[model samples]
Target: MLEISRRGQAMPVSPFRKLAPYAELARQQGRIVYPLNIGQPDIETPPAALAAVRNADIRVLGYSHGAGTESYRHRLAAYYQRAGLPVVMEDIIVTTGGSEAILFALLTCLNPGDEIIIPEPFYGTYTAFSIAAGVNIVPVTARIDNGFALPPLANFERALTPRTRAILICNPSNPTGYVYRRAELESILGLCKAHSLYLISDEAYREFCYDAPYVSALELAGAEPNVVVVDTISKRYSACGARVGALVTLNKQVYVAAFRFAQMRVSPPGLGMLLAEAAAELPESYFDESKAEYQARRDLTVARLQAMPGVVCPRPGGAFYVLAHLPVDNTEAFGQWLLESFSYENQTLLLSPANGFYQTPGLGSQEVRLAYVINRTDLAAALDCLERALLAYPGRTEPPLTTTEVASAFTAPLLTQLQ
Candidate 1:
């Protein structure tokens, strides 16, 4: 008989990947599905990065250094310096991706039963990585009404047990796409220092802010000795396939500890490093243009969603997602209904239920995450389908009134009348 480890039994499959079969079915049915569920961008990778690979003169595709090619690391350090996340080559460990960097960070920093605190409506992969590394993920809830900002310092402080080892923050958060403000980041930095906790800041979408300014955890250098910054070129370079990222830190002890895990793996992708090095050298203007395009898509998506009945979507400052609170009883069911039952003009929208992102069960049952990863024309149609589905879909609760007469659903009646 085959047996699995206790961790394997207790661990859940990734919620995002589970939807693949259904998405495939829809594609085969010839339904034009707008992928609002994942962050795989449709943007073009810069020619410089692509050219670096095509023009490479490799003879034998040999494994590079375990920590990645020195030239690549050195160039990466310089790139971070330009982005305000100053680092030295020795302080950076180029991993397979931000995902591997996270796993390594957890494995190196935490032992079994040790905990890492994360906010609710987080990136789903974080949960899986924590479990794989035998670390408990303690989630603190952040409200959608408040634009998914960091929970108050007191909330994090209260969740802290003696076994708490680190606080993980995903800036310009996934799913919700809300960017962290300077003051909020400062508050959390103070708490990390006070509690002597390692702050693992995941800045994967550092350049995606569309509203409020972004604050880097690395910027809090003089405050503490436990800050570990995790970053990747996946989203930045529109190179999800690149599989190149880094674990950066100024904390010498933590860096040494993390490096041990790096040594265990022979090396990360070699060809990917060549592309990543060129990506690191991509001109600043490339990012400026990409950010502008994402901002336009976000603006169109939010405005259209806000017009729909029973939907409350806040404009995100960064990232390419919008966490929308819908009128349905369960977002999980609503997501299925969108793909399985309803379509408008032969088009349907694929959404990720907000429940998976929320660690607290039943809390985000009425919410769904919409990734504005498509062009404006496609996004408009997707929003239209969502509006039609909201009206037609049958759920447990009475649907919110989304009639043309009512422009705003959440506002007080008096306010609506005044407007």
Candidate 2:
């Protein structure tokens, strides 16, 4: 029989969506699901952006320039500049989504057998992309006690090997929501410069920072050649359906190479670019209102999680996610039970099991990542379900893993099981 390739066989299933079958089963049984599993926000997309698509005067929806239409790229450059990144039209390559941009960065900067280092409890897709690119990931562990701050520089230094080609970071990180400050950025920049390594900074959550000012990798002076930023309108504009994003770098060679890869995909979505251009021109007040809403949601999420017995959720500085350590022995089993067997007022909550976020095994088994994308009412209901689920879960464990235990677990060898 013909067989799937090893690469295809080794691809990991997304922990975020793997239990979707159980979620569907619950919905079919007439239960309301408070979805905290993914990052799909309920915020409205800017009216102007929607209007632009509605009023388009195109005779035919033709493919745009491979890099992106000149007009859209120019507008995007301006948007980045206004947001404090020193970007120009030439530095941008429009992508199908941030996922494509990440794949492009990995493929362009590293060859097969090359290695890239990432912080543990990162966006799970990073592992999928690295596998697709035939690249290996070396992970450094970050602590939950400190809101998953960047692992010590020494940890990064230890993970480096002769085959290391780049270091990837998600500022305002996806699973952890820990935003890196300028000092952390500089420390990583110093390492990249010293080792002549590429820095792929995924700043998809740049606009959602609640507490601290965001410092883009693009803002790192004299590190232009080393920094490649992967950004998207999905999170910023609450337009995940648009599927528009960009790979940006001041380095001419990287930009040119990425442009060539963009050519292979022909062009990004035409209508999405039009929408993104209009989004670029939205008034500052648009973000002000949106950020206020998300901040309220984040505040509610952290507070409620803190109130839950046997739950430890540190306040995340940015992004809409918080990683909470639960008293359960296995979050995967507990998550499945939440959908299949547990509910409160006929409502159950679905969460992304935190284990998938870590490259190292046995690190996140007792944790889960929650997205505060829903409104306060629904979020409160979800928290209610979670609290009850924890108390009733059969796998409940007492005295949650201490910081010392967690630190030791980080050194455990990677497990072969995907979960």
Candidate 3:
């Protein structure tokens, strides 16, 4: 038998997709599955972005500059400048996607066995990425009860160690949809500055910030050397397949180091560069309609979840995701049961088990993250399936029977699994 690398063995699986085999089996059995598990947007990719590929004259499909095409970088820089991040083309290095940018950031900023502080229930991929980069993740737990707000400065102070090298955050976060207040960002940046630590911010969902203004890590005054932003066009333009993202920094040293790593990969995706440049050309007003649509969907999702007994969902300020506690014991088992055993009107729903989002053991066992990316009609249908499933779910830790439920001996026994 061949031995595998220890690092490869330790890579965490994606919570969003880990149950895909169950979903496939459900589909094969003729059940319709509405996957609310992943943040793959159902919104149409901008026509301009698609056209850039369809209309391009390049026959060779050759490699672009390792730092990405200079023209594309300029386009990205201009787009950032409008967002109030004062960056030039030289300040950015395009990568295959946000994942690659994160890799660049991690590899450049921290040594193997060094630690990067990240809040709990963060983007799940960060765990895999850190493992791949040979870095240790130090999680400062943030409570779901507080809408996943940033833990206080003292929390960061307490987590610090000699091996700590950086902190990573996702604004309008991926799983919980929590947007960091500017003051929170400042305080975190102050911690980084005080400790001479790097701050890597994943701003992929910036455009979808619904309630409050999105604050980029770049906005903090005089912390250029301490801040690095990882960005992507996936969610912004509904162009996940484009695979274009950037590592942005005003610090010359970090930029140079990340660029060197970029060269080793030859270049970022070529066609993606074209697609992103086209997307960057889109007007700022484009986000307005998209934001409104997502905001409405977010409202629909939260309202539906809140109405369910024993469900606790905090209204998130931004992003298209909602992290909610269900009445179940282990959400992974519950999610699998939804695909394997339950259906309403021949329909089933897929959900991301929230435990995979946390580095802390057993933290998200009772939670699930739902993405409200589908349009209202489909979203409504999916939520309907979820509600009925929860009412009938056998794995729930306790009965969530209501007055109406108590009135029905039918619902009461099912809620308690007494049958």
Candidate 4:
């Protein structure tokens, strides 16, 4: 038998993809699964973006610059400027997706066994990426009680070691949909500066804020050299398949290091560059309409979940996710039950269990992330399923369920599973 690399063994399986088997089972059961599991949006891609790719009169598809096509980079730089991040085309290195941009940052900025601090219940892929690069992930806890706000600066200070290399964050975060306030971000900036640490801001959901203003790490101009912004067209333009994202920084050293990493991957998706360039030029109303739609879904989902027994969901500031602490003893098992047996109106729902989001063990055990990617009607129905399932499902410690699960009694999951 062939032996696998130790790095492969060291890596954790992606937590989000673990639902595929259950989702397939749901489909096999002839059940309609409301997909609250993934961040894949249902918004329409701009016609102009599609037309750009379709109209390209290319005789031969050729790889462009390793940093991405010049034209696309220029447009992307302009997009950042419009979003209030000052940047030049040279400051942008287009990658296959935000996923790759993250990988590049890890490879460029961190050495093996170095640590990157992240908030608990963070983007699940961060664990995978950290492990793959042989970096240590220092997860600081942020409770669901505070709506998953950034933890106090003192908590971050407590976790720091000489091995710490960077602080990674997802603005208007995934799972929690908690947008960090300007004050919170400023505090974090001070922490990073004091520690001389790199700040990696993953703004994958930049345009999705529903309730609060976004604070970009780049906005702290003095921190420019210490901050790197990772952006993608996946969520912004609802172009997940485009595979176009950029690693942006004003830090000359970080830029050069990341440029070398980009070369190893060759050019990013060729056709995607064409489409992303067009998407960058889309009218401001594109986001306005998208924001309005997501806000409506958020409103419906929050209201419905609040009415459920043994469930407490925080209304998110932005993005499409709400991390609800279910009354269940084990979210993984409950999530499995949801896919395998539970339903309302003959429709079931899929969710990403919260355990994987936390780096520390035994945290987020009772929480599950719900992505409100569907329309209002479907979101309403999914909430109905949860409400009924909590009443009917037999996982809670208490026999009779509260109107909404008491926030205080809920526990985080014990284990993080590989997908």
Clashing residue pairs, candidate 1?
208-318, 209-318, 210-317, 211-317
Q: How many Å off is the CA of 292 in candidate 1?
A: 0.5
Give the poorly placed runs of model 3, Cα more than 4 Å off.
Answer: 400-419
Model 4 Cα lDDT, one tens digit per residue, 279-377: 888877778989998888888878777766667888899889999988889988988988887876678888888898888999988889888888776
Q: Total clashes, candidate 4?
A: 8
Winner by TM-score between candidate 4 and candidate 2: 2
Candidate 3, residue 337: the lDDT equals 95
lDDT of 2 at 199: 97
Q: Write the per-residue lDDT of candidate 1 for residues 93-133, one digit (tens) a residue.
A: 99999998999889877898899999888998888888799
Identify the runs in model 1 with alpha carbons over 4 angstroms from their true place: 221-224, 399-419
lDDT of each: 0.82, 0.90, 0.90, 0.85
Ranking according to TM-score, highest score first:
3, 2, 4, 1
- TM-scores for every predicted model: 0.93, 0.94, 0.96, 0.94
lDDT of 3 at 353: 95
**Superposed Cα deviation of residue 62, candidate 4 (Å):** 0.3
For 1-419, candidate 3 gives per-residue lDDT tens digits of: 99899998998788899999999999999999998999999899999888998999987988888899999999999999999888999999999889999999999999999999999889999999999999999999888889999998888899999999999999979899999999999999998998999999999999988887889999899769999999999999999998999999999999999999999999989888888999999999998889999999988888888877789999999989999999987899999999999987899899999999999997999999999998888888888788777777877778556757644633332221110
TM accuracy, model 3: 0.96
Q: What is the C-alpha RMSD of each candidate to the true structure, in Å?
A: 4.3, 7.4, 3.9, 5.8
